[model samples]
Target: MKGRSILLDHVGEREAAALMVDGKLEDLLIDDDSQPRPGAIFRAICDRPLKGQGGMMLRLPEGETAFLRQSKGLRPGQPMLVQVTGYTEAGKAVPVTDRVLFKSRYAIVTPGKPGVNVSRSIDDEEDRARISAIGHAVMEGIEHGLILRSSCAGADDDDIAEDIAAMADLASAVLNDLEGTEPEALTEGDGPHVLAWREWVSAAEVVTDEGCFEDHGVMDQIEALKSPFIDLGEGHMYVEATRALVAVDVNTGGDTSPAAALKANLAASRMLPRALRLRGLGGQLAVDFAPISKAHRKQVEQSLRASFRNDAIETSLVGWTTMGLFELQRKRERLPLAAILRGL
Candidate 1:
């Protein structure tokens, strides 16, 4: 329990995966089989463009529609390939993008962007050069770009080459079906089990048994996420989701010392990302930190920056509001766990 461990299990009948680090739940992925999943590739037909939004609606197979925000030079009925980018709210169009990427464990093939690049985290010059050479060789004549992931740093050379080649081949195969007239799905996105294997590349013990969730305490952790209150030892925070945005209110509890406000604010900031990730909460987030002096604002901001830096979801710190609240805009990548587990 000291190191990382991946729990491959289910919440009700849906496939689920959990990342446990040192006995704490670090991340969670659960399947929502009702709609087109994020990262799924589809050949769609352009429907119509929004007047002032500069975006277009796409018609997919089975009467589903997606919204593409960067639709320029696109005409109605034009056929094109698109990839689902994120989850959709009820009755809302599935958000998609024309920039389709074929991602695997070690490589990501970027169509229309031709370059061989290594992850910036791999700081060793020799390792970067080696990875670059492998990518360039595997993608010599291919038009698609290749990005070597950070996991390739100490991985076997043969495995890295194989992964790159396989993703490139898959991308080519999918891109070639653009001539099809009828809208259809090219590839379904990876399920929770496969996604955990692909994204959680760090060394960890794998648990695939049926009762792994209950055995490893993942079920208990998930139950805690169902509530909005989070205990931070010295203080607590309430994370409430509204239709417009998520509201986080931090309290110093009984601590009334001069540093109590700063302490509670820092604790909330450190735990905020993990809480949101577990609950699959996104969109706008407004945090009402306990009252602290203007001089301590920088410290709180830095804490937030450091906490969100490691989060996989895309989040932008939009700075402080006039009312002294912190705001953030996060991409809605996954369905809310409560919604997924509803009625179960």
Candidate 2:
């Protein structure tokens, strides 16, 4: 199908389940596909008159502080190598250390605003030759004196071209739409997952003989759904939040023995941190395991340590509280997926 239908349920014990897939609840619309959106970041010369800098400015594909340098090294008007120092503020491009700083804002290219912005109204020749190589580009913005990620290796001229084209196309569409219709439009490009999977590889070492796929992403997703408990039946538990000032409550559901239940809780604890990372939850966590013996507490602690073997985020367990709480903390810079799910 050209599109996927996602159903999210947040009303009852049955949290989320997909009923209809493509365009039907059964097997309809399973063969069609849609085109992917073109995404890019451009790098080009800035030839704009800055408010206080000078006659020429350097702009990056995404930053603001353009590296301002004396115009004495290269061609007067052409594209060259640059770096992404920092983003622009009100009206400036900030560059980093070791730069060819110049007095100019990066003029983000597009199909509409194709040329380098020289002033409030002036523009220079479009770097069409270099930009056309990309499939379809979009110029996000023009910024102050700075270089962009385009200077990095693997960011070919094709990316620049694609970015320019995308921006141009969007601008044209906006103008056309505005002249005859609505003024507000939302357009989003590819995101982090696309970038992360750019160089992903996988292999299968062990699997059931019945039906196993060669690609690991499939198993990985399935494993993600299963609870870490080795023999807890097919029922799986999903958690929300990555790191936060939160607490975990335990219930055996039907387990009877106190120590066994405690051991099960310990097993569950071992999996909690992993879920936190997967859900992108961060901050403080106070987990209360089922009341068990001190030995089981030790086991839980050890399991907690084991689960964090490959975490990129920093975490610390302050040991259990006198009241039987597992105190821990995870630092973060953004809201985790757990929060997103809960909020939804």
Candidate 3:
């Protein structure tokens, strides 16, 4: 509530910085220097690898390299291990491998725990193989993973062995500074806003809720809300949060055909515009559909305004309402993906 900004006054004791959404204030007020950051993380020089471009053309330390696109738990000649994960409105520094360290500590396991402990200060054998990789991410509940060195968050076991012998002596001086040629590190991380504040400063997630599938025409009571915890795929939908102000009715979740209501309204309008950029749903929002067949309402509002054409937000659709509602207006910026994974 009460946030959204974009001002830019004349020097000195600020004149504005207001731009709030969901609790409304917006219209963009930018007065500059709210502290700019988007760089830092060293080493990068090893280009040459674009033959058929599956990947490999690095040469960064200052300029090029940035190709790295191998999704679904990335991989390519192993030993990669990235972690930055954010910072690229143009200022680079956006790594993110080791499958985001096993999905950012995936709801930190606690089920009758027998394992899942991390302590360090350097002892050896790669700090006992990073504490046997956090005891195999607490008995393989690691649908994700990452363990480089963090001075052991809240140390104990002899202050995590003096921080795992100082990261096994900086991994033995990064293996004696890569012993003469061929290196491509950039591990300086923590930007995508301080790595979205250590992934939303923890402490939350108590309750939740469902989905299903069965080829073409479904409904065994909707294929019994398919599970692995909800994934109503036709295209995709995973909006874990936005808190409020996101109103998307788009019926056809009962479906028929304007084409299977523009394919379940184009798989939930591209999964509600990427669940409104990962559920950060800002102020005035609306997306009510499921009537469009008056000979296909302007071809489904021109295919939902060409699927909000690569939205940067600042949307508008005002076209149907004699009870066919299709009004639209999305304009929230910053902190979304469900309030930076709800650490807002």
Candidate 4:
């Protein structure tokens, strides 16, 4: 409860993983069996170009269609490898990209982008040099790009090299199967347990027992997320998801001090990333902070930026609107938690 803990368990029949920091739920991952998950590699056939949208539709296995935004050189009936980028909204084609990547815990192999680099987070020159040498050694003849993740810092040399080699091998095998005429699935995306192991690389206690979610209060936290309200001690925030966007409203609870508005706004900013992460909410987000003076807008913006800086999801702080609201655009990388657990 005091430190970080990784809980691997199940939510109903679905596999789930939870990351808890200081006894608070920091992140959540739950398997959704309804769609083609992000990171799935496929050999797709170009169907037709949406000239109006400047995109092409790809035919995947099981009669599913994917939408690729970059369709400049692609023609109908051409075969290409694509990766599912994110969840598809209802009645929309799955979003995909031709740039496929093979990712693991310690390394990521980027196909068509040839280079060997280490994570910048490894600030130590010696560590970076050592990791770089390992990567270059393993990928000497490989044309695919190699990126040594931050987890390689201070890691065993043998382990890092093995990881790099494994990912490189996977990329090579997948890239070589581009001659197929029909659409096919090359690999599935990482599941909840595997994702937790890959992304939550910092030192932490690992709990893999059955029903660990219940044992660690993760289920309760998830249940609370079903509601729109979130308590921030002195104030509260409401996070509700609409078909168009996520709406957040901040309010100072019975606090009439001069700085109460700013205080509540800052609190909302700090807790917003984690809240959205747990809920698996993305796309457009509009935050209506408690009415603060223009002088405090910059401070609130800084707070929001800092909070989302380290989040794994890509989020763009689109800045304040003409009205008194802040906006964000986030990648829809995962299915909504509420939708995933609706009847379970």
Worst 10 residues of 1 by lDDT: 335-344
Better of 1 and 2 by lDDT: 1
Error of 1 at 36 (Å): 1.4
Clashes of each: 0, 50, 35, 0
- Over 4 Å off in model 2, which ranges? 1-191, 198-244, 338-344
**Candidate 3 lDDT over residue span 207-317, tens digit each:** 111111111112221122221122335322333322454556554554454466666555566545545543335455655555446776667677667767855455676
Clashing pairs in 1: none
List, residue by residue over 279-343, the lDDT tens digit for candidate 4. Answer: 99999999999998899999999999999998999999999998989999999998888899884
lDDT for predicted candidate 3 compared with the true structure:
0.39
Residue 224, model 3, lDDT: 26
lDDT: which is higher, 1 or 4? 1
Q: Pairing residues by index, what is the TM-score of model 1?
A: 0.98
Q: Evaluated with lDDT, which candidate comes out highest?
A: 1
lDDT against the true structure, per candidate, is 0.93, 0.40, 0.39, 0.92
**Model 2 scores what on Cα lDDT?**
0.40
Instruction: Tell me the RMSD of model 3 versus the true structure.
Output: 21.3
Q: In candidate 2, residue 47 scores what lDDT?
A: 46
C-alpha positional error of residue 284 in candidate 4 after TM-score superposition, expressed in Å: 0.5
- Candidate RMSDs in Å, in order, are 1.1, 17.0, 21.3, 1.0
TM-score of each: 0.98, 0.36, 0.26, 0.98
Model 1, residue 175: displacement in angstroms? 0.4
- Model 2 earns a TM-score of 0.36
Q: Model 3 TM-score?
A: 0.26
